[model samples]
Target: MKPAAFDYHAPATANEAVALLADLGDEAKIIAGGQSLVPMLALRLAVFDHLVDLRRLDELGGIEARGDSVWIGAGTTHAAVGRSAEIRRDIPLLHRATPLIGHFQIRNRGTLGGAIAHADAAGEYPVAALTLDARMHTLSPRGTRDIAAADYFTGMWSTAMEPDELLTGVTFPVWRGRTGFAIEEFARRAGDFAMAGATVAVRLDADSRIEQVALGLFGLAPTPLRATTTESEVLGRPAADIDPAEVGRSATAALNAVPADIHGSAEFRRRIGAVMVARAWARAVEEASND
Candidate 1:
């Protein structure tokens, strides 16, 4: 199906893009990469009077390491992030998860900001962002602000972004301690969106005891969720002693609702989520031990 007729505007700057959004309001949608948005538009799942393209915005097209953090422009492609030495060095979780996003063609055209803005519950970027505790920067006619990863995603395919705001970039703080990361996901095929997934990052003390751990669960709830309960159980425990199955149960216990669709039942998704969490935790533990 073809998308409804809409006006298109290519903004050379973020200011111009936000200004266009301010004028068009809810009628305008900002598009970058066009991986997620274009498909939705084509399916008529989303209807907009105008599309404000951010591809030409120079201010939103670079990757840089700033002090203790890595700043990735919203317009940067997934493929670029996956291959970036700086990203792999500063934020290995993101680097490791980028390849799981989609096939090569999709990653080459998918933007970090677009994926986060789309906020698909099954998106790998959201899981990585949550596990890394990333922050999102945004601009609007009124002003600019930073949104914490925990607060950024409000629902499935929904975010805190206002109609007139534009996502400018994402900032991820470099892990300070000895850290290990792993992302485990299950899909019908290599490039398919994960049916369930877990993104895990663990920081260990010199003694090999877990100091800090984060587990982000995807495709099992309305929004990406941090397995805080599971982290609590794993913290301070020796990597070898941490039980992945128990951690999985703890994480799922905190979730009040499990999503069910034509793809799977509520119970099935919950079980899959548990398995993903277990696999991710085990791999993360192994990696941390080696580090």
Candidate 2:
């Protein structure tokens, strides 16, 4: 099947995009990377009367650092972000997670903003955004606003963004000293959507104890979920005292009702998610120790 017939509009500026969206309302869909949307459109899973292309917007295509935070333009490609020296230096977690997103070809065209806007539960960008506590910036004909990652995702394939809103960019606060980061994911094959994945960022004090931790988990829920239960359990604890296997299990123990599908059972996914969280936690500890 092919996508429903739609009028296409290429907007050269952010404001123009916002105006198009406002005028078209819910009938308009923004196309950036077109990685996810194109497939959906091909399958007739999604339909729109208008396609608002943001590729020509030069304003939404760069990486910049402002003080303790880094702002990544919505139009920036995964490949561009992966190769950025500044992003690698300022935000190691994102740099490390980028390679896991599909393959080189997909990365070359996939935009970070597109991924976040899609809000796929198993998406790499959503996991990074959640773990990093990134802030999403949006523009509408009415005004502009910033939505915290915590509040941005409401459910699978759903977000806080309104129909007329345009996601301009995202800002992530840089983690400095004594921080270690790791990403662990399980997929049927390379470049396939992960069955389950976890990203861990840990900070240690001078005593080598865990000072802070953020765990973002995917593929086990409707939305990318932060393992707050696990964080509370492990925070300020000595790394040596925490067992990776046990921590992994306990981290997702509360989610006994995880979704079951053709790829896996609820139990199987929970088990895989647990192990990922454990591995990520262990690797993060090692990273922090060596830092």
Candidate 3:
């Protein structure tokens, strides 16, 4: 279906994009990759009087390594992140998860910022950002500001972003210690939205004991959920002696707030979430020990 009639503006600069959004106000939507927004537009799930296109904005489409963090442009595509040498070497978890998003075609068209702004519970970017304690840079008519990843998410598809704000970049800190990353999910087919999924990143010391662990879940909550309970349990312990299934069960209990749908029941999600969490955590352990 054709999208509802809307004016389109392709701005060449970030300032121009923000100005357009400020001028259009709530009637405007900023589109980068257009993978998610286009579908919403076509279905009339969203109607805007104007679209502020940011694809041409040079300031929002590159990756850089700064002092201690890896900065990813808001307009950077998933394929770019998946193929980046820096990501593969520094943040391998994100590198592995990027290819699992949608499919090859969608990855080429989906923007990192778009996915974060869309805030789909099942999307990989949100969890990855949160797990890494990433920071997002946002601009609006008011001015530019940085927001911590944990505080940015408000609800399903909702964020701290103002109507006129455009996300410009995301930056995540690097860890020097041994780290492991893992993701597990259940889907009817490759690239389909998951029935349930989990991603975990763990840091370990030379002794093989956990230094830190961040656990996140998708398709089992309104927003991508950080499994604090599970993280608390695994930290300071080596993966070898830890019971993944037990830790997973604790994490699974945190999904009590997840609403049920035709895809699965609350109980089923709890079960699957436990399984995924266990598997992902185990992989994280292996990577920490071997790598």
Candidate 4:
């Protein structure tokens, strides 16, 4: 099916893009890389009257290490992010999770900002941001504002963004000492939209005990969920004392009701999610201690 006709505006600057969005209001959609949005348009599921293309905006694409954080521009392609030296050096979790997004072709076309803007609960970037406590910068013709990742996602396919807002970039804080991060997922097949996935971030103390743990999950709820329940139980515990199986069991405590579809039952998804969480946690912890 052909998409409904729409006006397209390719803007060269962030300010111009924001202005286009403000003028188009609710009728406008932002296109970067066209990974997710293009599909929606082809299926006739989305009916945007205008599209403000950000691909030409030089200001929105790049990856660099700032003073305290690695700043990833909104327009950076997932493939670029997957191979970024900065991302691999400062945050392996982001690098590990990027390949899980889709096939090479899709990753080549998918923009980081597009994923966040789409706000898919099962998407990779959302969980990464949530677990990292990254900061998101959004701009509108009115002005610019920064929002914490913890507060940015309101629901599945929903965000704190106003109608005219454009997400410009994300800032993930650099960790101190030796840090270990791991990502694991359970899907019907490799590269499939993960039926369930989990990301674990572990920071060790001088003694190498678990100092801070952030567990984030996708396809476990309405939004990329931060698993504080599992985190609270893991902190300050020796790696030997915590069973990998026990951490997996804690997944059930963090997630109760997951969406049930043909891919799997809600109950089954919760079980798989738990197992993945445990594996990722143990893997991260092991890497942290060996260093």
lDDT per residue as tens, model 3, 1-291:
889898989998888888888788888888888999998889988999988888788788888989788999999999999989998888777887897899999999899999999998888888889888899999988889999988998888999988888899999887667888898888768998777889989988889999988998888887888888778877888668998998789888856676688777888888998999999988988988887
Instruction: Compare candidates 2 and 3 on lDDT and give the better one.
Output: 2
Off by over 4 Å in 4: none
Residue-wise lDDT of candidate 1 within 1-291, one digit each (tens)?
999999999987888888899888888888899988888899999999999888898788789999999999999999999999999888988998998888999999999989999899899998899888999999999999999999999987889999998999999989877788889998889988888889899999999999999999998888889988778878898887878998888888767678777889888888898889989888888887777
The TM-score values for the models, in the order shown, are 0.97, 0.98, 0.97, 0.97
Residue 80: error of model 4 in Å?
1.2
What residue pairs are clashing in model 2?
none
On the 0 to 100 scale, the lDDT of residue 181 in model 2 is 91
* Model 2 local distance difference test score: 0.91
Candidate 4 lDDT over residue span 85-166, tens digit each: 8899897889989989889999998999899878899888999999999999999888989999999999879999998889
RMSD of 2: 1.0
Steric clash count of candidate 3: 0
What would the per-residue lDDT of candidate 2 be over residues 102-125, giving only the tens digit for each residue? Answer: 999999999999999999999888
